[model samples]
Target: MNTDTIVAVATPAGKGGVAVVRLSGSEALAVAMGHLTASRLQPRKATFCRFTDTAGQLVDEVLATWFPAPHSYTGEEMVEISCHGSPYVQQEVVAELIASGARLAEPGEFTLRAFANGKLDLSQAEAVADLIDSATPAQHRLAVSQLRGGYANELKRLRQQLLDLTSLLELELDFSQEDVEFADRCTMLDTVAQLQSRVQSLLGSFSTGNALKQGVPVAILGRANAGKSTLLNALLGDDRAIVSPIAGTTRDTIEETMTIDGITFRFIDTAGLSQSDDELEALGFARSIKAAQQATILLFVRSVTIPFNAYATDDIAYFTDQCDMSSKHLFIVHNKCDLPHESNPPGHIVSAKEGLGIDSLKASMVAAMRKDASANDGVLLTNLRHRSALQRVQEALLHVAEGLGQQMPTDLVAVDLRDAIYHLGTITGDVTNDELLGNIFSRFCVGK
Candidate 1:
């Protein structure tokens, strides 16, 4: 636990209607009271007071609140001073506290103390940073879910089951000479299989979780003069891309982001995919293919003015050969429906010029991404660190299952079980190191 008192400007930089200066640790209240005109402060109650420096010069009128030890954010005595949001005023108040002996806090130090004091676990602490950085509703919901302990609780339950299994195996090892087995081998194998399945399910959720946490990438791809840029603008509800009737107008990918129904989608309007004689146009073609390969969803736009049956099959085949479309969610968007076209066009028909069928297209995109995420109680794994740890746990469980199937020695099986438990423990800080803690918390902003 940290022993020294720390102080910082808790709110964001720059002037607002109000600014907060936070102080924590053993000397927090004392350091704050030293400059306050108030004779005394009641715990957890806000008291309006006048603040002054050592020379007894007034600084600002502030509302001071004291949070006594063990009930505060860091589980230590804490003080929060709310004052007018003047940068100079915030600086003067902090300087006064520092002069009175409270050091400026390091990045994430306050939350680090909270973790050390058992106010929150490792995952929850990480969630605090996520919540602060959340830009969209989906990200906010995910961070909130983890912060509320649902994710932690589930992990803890799995770890407890593994610990129980390990205990039984350890017991069997101790009684090896007596030729007794505390655990039924058949039941043990089933348990290990079940655990591995659950871990694998979580590992599978990483792709969707990461996409939602970050915006989902959608690449708009088609041949030259196919109205791909028009579709991009329609989806974004803005003229984000330059629309031109000339061939190869867009020579590079133009990327933009828009939030639809609380989900953020990064739309990439790529240069048309076609055989180009010019070097720069050829380079654009290459980039367009790369964008298509990277995107989670692909919008293959085609103008309705063109004969659909004449070029549809050949174009689709060419694009399929150029990029891997097996993993991507593809939509053959027949754009310019407002123009004269055939009665039965293949795939989705839309008029980007008139804004027709764009809403349905967006709905389909969201549906495709949300389909896999709607399962497993919606407990998506968004952290790469957690995914990596769960992967190791999965591997360890696999080794345990293999050893039991091969009738390996009890001691060897026990070792693998312990390995699985350790990795699982790392996720929630049941097992952690100073280096890991420092790395995770350092990313947090100071005063948090």
Candidate 2:
């Protein structure tokens, strides 16, 4: 436990209506009181007071609130000073507190203390950072869910089951000399199978969770002069991409992001796919193919003004051969609907220049994502560290299942079981180390 008091400016640096400087630790109150006009403070009450330096000169008039130990954010005695938002006022007040014996806080020290004091688990502590950094509603909801213990509760249940099985297996090992079995091998195998299934399900959610956390990648692909860049500008409600009549105007990918119905989509407008004699144009085509391969969704744009038989329909054949579409959501979009066409294909028809049918296209994209999200359970695994730990748990469970199936010695099976438990424990901080904690908390902003 940290005994020395730590202080920091909690609010973002700049002028606002007010600024908050936070202090936490055993000596927080004493350090704060030393620089205030009031001799004592009422716990949890905001008292207007005059802040002064050690030389007894007034620095600022402030509203100070005190939170007693074990009930505050860090479960330690805490003091919050609400001062004028002037940069000089904020800096002077902090300097006064430091002169009175409070040290400057490191990044994430406040939340670190909260975790150290048992106010939050390891996963929830990470969620605090996520919630702070979330830009979209989907990301915010995922972070809030994890912070509320919805995800942690699920892991606790799994860890409890593993503990129960491990205890039984260890007991059986102890009774081996007597040639007696305490745990039925068949029952143990069944439990291990169930655990593996749950672990695998969590692992499966990582892709969707990560996509939601980081915007989903959507690649807009088509032949040259197909209005792919025009469609990109229309979807973004801005002229983000260059609109040119010349073919191959976009020699590389132009990326932009937009939030539709709370989900963020990263739209990549790639160079039009075509066999170009120019080396630069060919390099752009290569990048386009790479973008298509990585995209979760692909929009194949076609110009209605262009004849279907033009280029002998070789571009479509080339795209089909170059990209794997089996796992991706494919949308055929016919651009330039305002122009005359011989036939209307069976797909979305739109005029990118006039912003026609853009809303419908956005709706379709959202619908596809909703369908994908509906396939998973409510719990999502967004953190890469959690995903890695769960993956190890799955691997260990697999080994346990294999050993049990092969009728391996009880001691060997128990070893695998322990490995799975240890990995699972790492997620919720049932097992943790100094290095892991440092890596996690250091990412947080100071005074959080």
Candidate 3:
């Protein structure tokens, strides 16, 4: 446990109903009580008192709550002072606490202390930051599930299973001269295969999990004068992109974000895909192709004025070939539906200029996002770091299974099993380093 006390204003830096200054560590209570006029401070009870400086000048009429060691946020004595939301009052209270021997906390240092004191594991600690930053209902659900030991609990169970098997293999090594097998070869292979299957399942969820955690990328693709920019503006409900009847008016891609049914969709309106001799337009056209390739969802916008056969245009065909269209969720959208054209177009019809069919298009996008979403009742692996570690675990498990099949030495098999266990432990902080902790916690807000 840390010996020195730390203090910081735990609320946002602005005027509000109230602001909180928190203190933790051995001297937290002492520093907090030094400024309070009340003679008795009860644990877990909020005491209303007047806060004052060392010179007996009143600062604010605040409520202070005390928490004794081992039952508080940082597993140490803690105090929280709630005062009127004034920046001056907050600063003065902090200054008074510092004068009484509390130092300001560093970014994420409070949560780091909590982790160090065994209040939370590494995964749960990361979840603390996620819960704070969650912008939507889905994100909040995921963070809460993780904080409740979602993937961390599952990984712990898996690691324990591997550890048990490895111990059996180790025992066989000790009695190698007798040629006795402590672990059944068939049973060990079966266990490894099961572990591998679970790891792969989690690895597959990375795509959906990451997209939900961050924002989904949707790329708008079509030729010039296809109302691509108009469609973008309509989807955003604002004049985000310039619309012009002139061909190739959009020389570059315009990116904007909008929330659809609690999911953030980043829409990128790219330049039209046509053979252009102009240098900058050519560069933008190349960028458009790149965006189409990278987008999670592709909106192949087309105008009704353009014949339905335009779907087979050389540029469209080239783009389809360049991007493995099968990998991404592709949606064909016919814009300018109000105008006269062919009897049938190969997609959802919409008039971006008239705001028709926009709601249906949004619904389709949300459906695409939820197509593979199973009941997400437990923790999903949203962090790339967690996915990478699970991938390594999967590889190590595969090695163990293969070694067991080939009747490799028990000690060699044990090495692979241990490697798999170590990788699993990394997710739950059973095996971690200072650098990884620093990188994870640095993204947190200063007061957290």
Best by TM-score: 1
Q: Model 3, 145-229: lDDT tens per residue?
A: 7788557777777878888898889888889999998778998888888888788777877766777778778899988889999
Instruction: Report the lDDT of model 2 for residue 281.
Output: 91
Task: Work out the TM-score per prediction.
Answer: 0.93, 0.92, 0.92
lDDT of 1 by residue, 354-418 (tens): 99999999998888877756766788888999999999999899999999999999999999999
Where is the poorest 10-residue window by lDDT in model 3? 370-379
lDDT of each: 0.89, 0.89, 0.86
Indicate the TM-score of model 3. Answer: 0.92
Kindly give the number of clashing pairs for every candidate. Answer: 0, 0, 0
Residues 323-409 of candidate 2: C-alpha lDDT, one tens digit per residue = 776546878888899998878657788999999999999999998877766554678788999999999999999999999999999
* Clash pairs detected, candidate 3: none
So what's the TM-score on candidate 2? 0.92
lDDT (Cα, 0-100) at 291 in candidate 2: 85
Name the runs in model 1 displaced over 4 angstroms. 277-279, 307-328
